[model samples]
Target: MKQLYDQRISCPHCGHHIFVSLDASEGDQDYYEDCAACCNPIHLNMHIDYAINKLELRVDADDEQVF
Candidate 1:
């Protein structure tokens, strides 16, 4: 797996497309980034699955409630 990766994702707040840099060297990560278009917080959860050799990224709005 690559140590560094770039992913294009849409902002949950404004639906703006943006590029995010992911660092796989750190294993799994949970972080927040401000959307460029709306300036709203975007929650990012990154998980590296060693068994499948895949990187999973989940993006959502910071204010979203989980049911």
Candidate 2:
């Protein structure tokens, strides 16, 4: 299916705003990226529900996985 991915989310640790580009056409996925502000590792989860047209993203650090 087609997808639209455009959203800016701030890092929870350093509060640095980063543009997240998630491919909604793909399946549910998880990945890791570094925060440009703090240079810390971040676990990124992209949840796209095609049935409801919903997109959810959760980003966190190694120490802080929920916040």
Model 2 residue 46 CA deviation (Å) reads 0.8
Tens-digit lDDT track for model 1 on 1-67?
9999999999998899999999999999999998888999999999999999999999988685679
Q: Candidate 2 at residue 28, lDDT?
A: 89
Candidate number achieving the greatest TM-score relative to the actual structure: 1
Local accuracy by lDDT, each model? 0.94, 0.81
Backbone clash count for every predicted candidate, in the order shown: 0, 0
Query: Can you give the TM-score per candidate against the true fold?
Result: 0.92, 0.78
Q: In angstroms, how far off is 64's CA in candidate 1?
A: 3.0
lDDT of 1: 0.94
Cα lDDT tens digits, model 2, 1-67, are: 4586877888878999988777877778899888888987778898877788788888877584565
Error of 1 at 9 (Å): 0.5
